[model samples]
Target chain A: MDLPRLEAILSRYEGESWDLIPVLQDIQDAYSYLPKDELQVVSERLNVPMTQIYSVATFFKMFSLLPKGKHQIKVCLGTTCHLRGGGRVVESLSHRLGVEVGYTTKDMQFSLETVGCLGSCAQAPVMMVDDKYFGRSTVDKVPKILKLYK
Target chain B: MVWKISDETAYDTLGEEVHLTINGVTIRAPQDQSLLVTARQNGFEIPTLCYHRDLPSEGHCRLCVVEIGEHPRTQIVNSCTYPTQAGLVVQTHSETVLQARRMVLELLLARTPKAKLIQEMAAAHGVYESRFKTDDPEELCILCGLCVRTCREVVGVSAISMKGRTPDKQVATPFMEKSSACIGCGSCAFVCPNNVIPYTEKEGIRTIWGRDFELQPCNVCGNYIAPKYQLEHWAKITGDPVENFFVCKDCR
Candidate 1:
């Protein structure tokens, strides 16, 4: 969060704009999300405008501007998964998490998101909590699944 | 395998070590190795599409997903790019992982109804048919990144890349036009198990390439018969104005 640390990081990538990816990655790695202060530091050190930094961060889904919860729930809304009730799964999760998609809980417990696909079609209606899969899920199982995290 | 002196010198300069646990199994990997590589090396099968050892891991295909222990709720991540940390707990095939994978396959199947690999994979998962309105059956490619990787690594030509993002993402020649660097190498076709893009040489007209060719079935037994585009392209390339060549071997 300090300007000096960010300046040190940016100095490592001197004369290389392409290194911006790794620099941003390092920042995200240190802090789960890109803080505004860090973004400002990166902008100042890299000589890139704050708007441009924000644009690049927002362009890729991987870079999150806000702090993500310790647990991130990504529901696959791909065509196959959607047909098999991907929407229902997200709805159930949103209702249970008390937050809409792309929002983290106040306690920093969970973040709900809808991803395009996770590439496993055998189990439709899939929801990934943290990094594990819960397949063939229904609204009924949402409570039990959420309880496991607690 | 003879080791060169230079190779030995390079190996001696190695630094740093990391230990990670995948599915409760502890393994030591070099600092540079990704979690996916470690898991695969240990015989844990993580499904992947955009990942190839020879090419840079694009991490577009979310197939090789794993749940890292640091995250409390299951988060589907592209394991191909996620680095392995010391004390990392990875769950490769949990129920959450399986469900997410199934949905991805289903969506791909619906997008490209004619893709044999998608259909076959779906069937293997007990998915008889997609519930969504099927896309035009002419499509074949699953946009799995094989063609893109082949072009970049083996072909040494970055002619094709992932054009769109997420559900809309697909491998295409630059600007979605026929690439001059293609060299008609057919490497993309060869690596594509789905037979999505077929190369055809017509007799006179410009050769039609990279489009999904219809494989007509045998009239007698109804078995998938011949590559319609191949015959058409052959006729056009050879300057033979022939229509009867469309029939399959049995029918002919």
Candidate 2:
């Protein structure tokens, strides 16, 4: 919906066809999701077909076409994390949020997803919100940590 | 344009010839032309499921695999993607090649158990049953990608796409919707090797990918020329008047 902001992002990429991921990433960052019309605009500007753009957007887990929440919570489910009650932590978080994994909250405040690994096994049962990683995560600490975001 | 690939490129002999031995028989063909072309030119038939001369060679099916180099250092390669070169020793019907092709056919047979062509091909390869699991017993698509390549490369519309990875991959319109970009050309259905893509034509309407298109009739002969949408697309591409395409090419 922010036309000027979309134009600014397009200018940053110089509309190169091969920079599709970074362009989509920047657009996702700017709008929380790749808008359909904006993607059409990208298709026209870069001379790349819409199907290809859609394929690339859907192929990468990082890019989302649907509207995502303002805050994204990632639970690391690596071997160490899983052994250290990561499953319980995610279940409790999914319960409290009343949102399924890979879905945004109805209020659009939080989205929950699980990652294969956060590469922070020392911080087993790790849950991350935005850029901040919460180590030694527990079911009891979910609500408290979520409260800090909004 | 239908069945035109056989005339255009069944055997490519235009470029400088390169000699290669297949099964101890010397075969000559244009340098850098695929080994499949050279082999077929020399009366050696290599079984293929995903090859169409008009489309880009993807080597997707691996049905035309053959053993290359010599014994003890031979490597199995898809002849559809491997180019012929001088003195390159190849074996089109070696034991290793037969085994590899049979295994590929067996896997394909399991994947598309209902496809009659696959059944016939498997029967020819001496594989009556498959050892692998069949996820969908009625699945006819072998994921050879001929339809996908035709849609993207030749049509230039890219209305359909090959989405997802193994076991989940499928050729589908964007978001599985009736795509606005399809142009109703029917190229996808035309290029499908296993004849899997659902397409129907009746009366004056042609249907595919969940959309209907009116087939244009030649003004002079009353013979159907093409889909109205396809003629419109051709007009758009050639920058000519839409009425110019209403007549069939022969009538014109």
Best-matching candidate per TM-score? 2
With candidate 2 superimposed using the best TM-score fit, by how many Å does residue B68's alpha carbon deviate from the native? 3.3
lDDT tens readout by residue for model 1, B1-252: 122232112434433567888887888765555678778878998877666665567776576788877456556677888766777778998878887778877777777887777778777656656667665567777777787667656655445566535555556664445654454556677777677665664432223245433564555666554455445545655688646555567767
lDDT of 2: 0.86
Q: DockQ (C-alpha) of model 2?
A: 0.53
TM-score of each: 0.47, 0.84
Q: What docking tier does model 2 reach?
A: medium
Candidate 2: pairs in clash: none
Top candidate by lDDT? 2
Report per-candidate DockQ. 0.02, 0.53
Candidate 2 lDDT, tens digit per residue, B7-91? Answer: 2364453467778798898867788788887888788999999888777688989989989998899999999898888899999
Using DockQ, give the best candidate's number: 2
Candidate 1: Cα lDDT at B51:
69
User: Candidate 1: where are CA atoms >4 Å away?
Assistant: A1-150, B1-15, B70-74, B164-170, B175-177, B201-252
